[model samples]
Target: MSDTSERNQAVQIPQEAFDWYDAYAHGGMDRRTFMRKLGTLVAVGYSMSVLTSALLPNYALAEQVSFNDEDIIARYEVFDSPAGYGKGKGYLVKPATGAGRYPAVLVIHENRGLNPYVKDVARRLAKAGFLAFAPDALFPVGGYPGNDDEGRALQRELDKSKVQNDFVAAAKHLKSHALGNGKLGAVGFCFGGYMVNYLAAVDSDLLAAGVPFYGTPAPKALRNNIKAPLLVQLGELDERVNKTWPEYEQDLQANHVEYHMFMYQGAHHGFHNDSTSRFDKASAELAWQRTLAFFTKKLA
Candidate 1:
């Protein structure tokens, strides 16, 4: 490839552009507005196509572990959630060679539902010897639709309370599953991260541990109720989320909840998601190692 072509391929998206994408992805900004704002980057020599491609997630490039990997078993299964979504469905993966029960983890997705990236995360957890289940909050609305823009819209239509119930039900379901060893943990990113905090707060007995990556904090009233250990991950450049961290830390400490927080310098929100240009390799790897260690210690 020509040096110019290679340069274009390795183009570094400006942090401001990432802020725009993050707002759009989280519903604060509409697609038309986001794209129009991004178009301004063309004046600075960025092609619109390249800029768009860099911001949007390309799930094809995000898989770290495959669904059919020989070391793990992965499949879709339905679980009862009568009080929440009537019937919930999710991707479940577990170690293929393990005869004994494994510690369970509930993998929650972002607001866009149980997309491929989140399913891949479940597979990664299973590859590490944990029984992982990723429930689709969009199932009641017809599932993920294979497109994140559409998935986000579908998720917005659901009642937030019902969605929370669905995840709470998922935690209970995974904790009690036959293949689980009666210990349960959760890991979530962005919206999923908030769910992890919420889960830790709501069901102290059901969730033994949690990892929330750049998620919004649970309400202050609920923070004191959290008993499960938490490994909170954040990006230094994400002001929207980080602004709430101080009070959250105070709450956790005041309540004596066991926890540790990591702030990745120069990283932005969604740094752990490899499907986008915002992914910070060094931070993501270190966070994953810490996450695995935390789960291993607490789940055991």
Candidate 2:
């Protein structure tokens, strides 16, 4: 009856009990087997207090659970914006295993407007542990339906001033949200990429990182004002915007801006949008990995 022997006796569990409980918790065994093992542990003089602690629901347990359940779901829900701006509303895509105080990202949709691709991107960002918000940049004006033939039409309809205001408002809203970590970054595609660049110019104070995927080049005058670290993705074969990318790189270099410029070989515009056969899965995945890494380093 030595103290050490008594302590060891009290804490010991039969190997069968440990294996059964661990396997059941991890889904390798059934509940009946788990309870049978538990009964055995109690009979063997293990305290019920210990078993309760082991079996009780725990937040830490949720952390270890895989988000592989195919039936589990999450989606974007739009909340309010300031009065007077008809389309200042912001949408959030919450992860199924929701996090508190997660870092935030603002996703700016292309000139064709907010579509399923934009929402999917937001959800992917949320899955990566960011509080992702994709505000409708075209909402203040007439909403633009994405169409190949009408792409130019949609481009002509955007009101830059209002979009800028909406972006600023969205940034402020995300920074103050209850779930926000206050560290913010932005990602944009096509014309939205240009907006992301513009945001870096006007709202650098709030942004920790920026990624602009094939966005039009910003006016040279605004380059020096871009204070956040940026990652610019371009398609070398994109005839519409490829001509100006070199100058943009030069501007980034001259201003001593922290940036990464990636030119995808043989890729074209809209290469990152999965809905299109034009999507370059390899290049898009690489760019996405780079974007996520950049945000992790800068925003986390």
lDDT of 1 at 132: 96
Local error of candidate 2 at 298, Å?
1.1
Name the lDDT of candidate 2: 0.68
TM-score per prediction, in order, is 0.96, 0.69
User: Candidate 1 has what TM-score?
Assistant: 0.96
Candidate 1 lDDT by residue in tens digits, 1-300: 443343246347687888898899988999999988987888878777667666788798799998789999988889888779788999999999877589999999999989889999999999999999999999998899998999999999999988999898888999999999999999999999999999999767878999999999997778778999999999999999999999999999999999999999998899899877677789999999999999999998
TM-score of decoy 2: 0.69
- Which candidate's lDDT is highest? 1
Q: What's the count of clashing pairs in each model shown?
A: 0, 0
Residue 133, model 1: Cα distance from true site in angstroms = 0.3
Candidate 2 lDDT over residue span 113-228, tens digit each: 66667766777787787788888755555544544224334545556666666777787788777887888899998777887888788755878899999887666787788888
RMSD of each: 2.0, 20.0
Q: What is the C-alpha lDDT of each candidate?
A: 0.89, 0.68
